[model samples]
Target: MAQPKYRTHVGMVDILPGEVEKWQAVERIIHEEAKKFNFEEIRTPILEQTELIARGIGQLTDIVSKEMFAFERGDDQYVLRPECTAPVVRAFVGHHLEQRGGTQNLYYIGPMFRAEKPQKGRQRQFHQFGAEILGSDDPIADVECMAFMISVYDRVGISNMSLKINSVGDPESREAYKQALIDYFTPHKDELSEVSQNRLEKNPLRILDSKEEEDQPFIEDAPVIGDFLNEESSQHYAKVKQYLNELGISYEEDPHLVRGLDYYTRTAFELISPDLGAQDALAGGGRYDLLVEEVGGQPTPAVGFAAGIERLLLACKEMDIELSEPKSVDLYIVTIGDKARSWAIQQLPEFRKKGFSATMDYAGRSIKSQMKDADRENARYTIIVGENELNEGKFTFRDMEASEENQLPLDEIYGRLKKKL
Candidate 1:
């Protein structure tokens, strides 16, 4: 026997029938919550210029340096975007969305590609639903962004998640903290991992974001960004906490919580859930006032967060949250006898045109097997067509849940379904 030569990629997933229902439920809630926050949806292409990612996400960051799936085609280099914020900003700038006038609250739902060691929930091709607020530097904008994120999970019914927040300060204090980090880690340089050793002079904050076990010791004892927050940033950070408090949103201040991206400034946060084993972060985002300028736009303030839909489904499963399924079959038609089959097939489109989700067996299955299909599909009603019904000038319609059957003319069958179902 020749084995199948093709298979799904290692870190990719197929959202199949039974499982896709959960995705539908989660996405429904995401859309509903985003609507309440007044965030309109924006979609950017999955493929973006490789240089856009490298320049916007930062060359020193792990996403651009190691994980990007880049290729050169003709005169241009392209990458399957590892994240959406940069591209959203690029569209905002390139298309001049600012002409629309107010601070735009944009949300997106799509797949983001990144090559990483595949794990449960965190896949190479993962779906994310995130919202970004452009043109507002107000600390309230940051609080609202976090609140919007928290509200999405709340509506999703995924409990036991904690919000952890911090401030990276602005550029000046960030620079001060980098120097302080260099001073502190220079002595223990030999104990650091080669990656940390390489990142020390270029961007030491990324070293703090490292996952290498060997780098943890120095990372733990390193100077915290809180200690380096300049007065203006200190006020900004205080305002974010105060707003969160005013709105009754609880959070824990985490000094070491610098986001993984380089453009982040001022506020940073993560939503952590114990449902994910080692990598507990369910979502993370922060303020990136410099990202618009970094992506070729006029300097604009933005705040957003991205959460993995796969991880969210896992978390829902762990919490025992019930996910509602999508619409089931409204009508299943079972035809017997060649003449009745021919007649039923002709009527199928008519039933559908009357706003019923109707389907039938074209494979000439037995009545018993056709009825089984109706039951498996959770059909609300099943209509039986046969020589007896054709001769009687009526059809046999069954209320599947109540086990009641009635003989009615074609128009009356539609009336009964419309009235009762």
Candidate 2:
């Protein structure tokens, strides 16, 4: 017989038991925080029309230009969603979620696909939990979204993160800033990285997000969007900062922090953890007032943020914060004979029905081996029943943790275990 191939694809990972517990811990916090903020859950498909991302994320952006897993399907082109915001917007438009006319607070937790080189805290298939607030352009909405993001990090025990924020302004202001960037970077075009050189002509704002070492020196001096913010955008940014200060959240204003998305306007922010090395951004979002309109819906104002679950766990690990372990079964039953095995099967379901996690050895192993397996499962108690014990109508009840043993009637065992558990 041939051995079956058993390997995960490149840039993807299988989350085994131990690590999955940590992921659950983070997800619980995400759900809990979302509820507290009045954000309902919305799940969108993992695949979306290729044009949705192209139009939403912008054609010149690296995610659309290079990293999306796009392919032709029949008469249409589809791509595994590289991000969720665009798909969520597509859903909002398709479902007419905004026709009723009030703000919709929605959140989602799922895997996003991006065809990028795998690295620590990054992969082709990565998970993100994000929230979107649609309908209101108020600065308080931006503050609320940011506060919720910070609260999630706090609840997850990731405290040493820095929040860097900036305002890219409205479209008119952004265009003026873009021209300034082109004018400034054009003089040093010969020295800029190849990617930045292309970005300069295509979408100069992307040059600010470039990680190219050669581009850094020139990028730092290129242009500051804050300098060109119009009256409305400037006041909106100021109010967001004011509210964040009132909420006592410390943040740094970064002139070059334009998020790597075309839809963002007015406010942009990123939470960075020093522990994540080169991939330091733990989460990021901003106001995208034009996204809905861009995706064929009414012009709606919205704000959102997405944090990488892998990055959050990495931050927790660096801080030496341990997540609570999943609870194990209350008891493991060891049956030493056929009669005892039948008796064990009868009692197992009763224990489970009574809300106690219960299990019995089905492999018919030796008592010692069964006990070892029980220990590995971290069972709080172990019940050993043998032919003699079953005949005597009593069983050996052992407390795994305390290493104490007691002989109890078979009928009385369930009640006693229930109380102890």
Candidate 3:
């Protein structure tokens, strides 16, 4: 019988070198944009207490009830993070990050796990890069967060994208709207999808964002949250829109843009690209003022967004945007004979120490074969060391691109390559 070949787990992918380069390019833009906005990077664990996510993301949401990868270990129940915001908040409160009492601007880039069925641009094990600003409820914070997110997408050269904004309103107003959604959805109970019907009783706002074909007609006619916003929430939403307008940023108002998570309160937004069909969102987030207190921190207001790295890359591919390729080695050293091979081994570190990417043959291949490898790697220069050259204290340097060769003394080789590089 033949043995089974190993394969990558379903919904999980191995990011090989060529594809990883594109991911790195996107991450570079994220880091650069985050730095420009004065947001520091923060890394949190992938695993957290199950209760944290259940409470933070809400028991009623699909992420907490249906998607989370959770299990019990001994006496403790833990879960792989389905999203970043809840874990970020857990870290913030657990570490007492708010002890200083000022706004905390933090960013993260890492893998997030969920158990959802995979589709184009959606996966169970995926990556997210996002920012969270804790301790500020001011409308300017919301505006700046959106601006920073848009700037990242702009820097990445992704086009044909649109920003949709909405305000779910404060807790009081949100509750009133929830009741309104219940009233509207209850009439169409038998027509609602099984998933949406469950959400109708648990969290009716989620039904508005549902992808169910059967529920769209009813959701389209449902009452808009904007109509029910309280005075303060309404003014806050207006100021956010005004700031976006003054910044020359264009956006469309989306009354049904309630985010997937239950913690979000006011200022919900999503950036969608036409390239991704069906699952069109490239990134989304909103204000979550009550989450901090729910997770055992003091009442702190915050807003932020997270973009899927894979989805962003997908958009780039659809638009034919070229990402940066990794640079090749500066030199490939080819050696002949025992003395030359030993010398090449010793000199390899010297070349690298001077900031040159240098590689040499370790498989004891022929000089001709090593030269072929050098060409395949696109090495700029190839150094040939032989018995004669070792005895003469000189080396032969060939410029691969120009097809030029020079015989330089051992000490002069470094200077010559440094100048060329």
TM-scores for all candidates?
0.95, 0.97, 0.97
Q: What does candidate 2's lDDT look like per residue over 23-135, in tens digits?
A: 88888989999999999999998889999999999988889989999889789999999999999889989999987668998899999999999999989999998989999
Which candidate tops lDDT? 2
lDDT of 1 by residue, 209-295 (tens): 787899998888889999988898999999999999999998998888988788899999999998887678888899999989988
What's the ranking of the predictions by lDDT, best on top?
A: 2, 3, 1
Candidate 3 lands at a TM-score of 0.97
The C-alpha local distance difference test score for the whole of candidate 1 amounts to 0.89
lDDT of candidate 3?
0.90
Could you tell which candidate, 2 or 3, scores higher by lDDT?
2
Residue 287's lDDT within candidate 2 is: 93
State which candidate, 1 or 3, has the greater TM-score: 3
The list of candidate 2 runs beyond 4 A from truth reads 1-4, 99-101
Look at candidate 3 and tell me the lDDT of residue 147.
91
Candidate 2 overall Cα lDDT vs. reference? Answer: 0.90
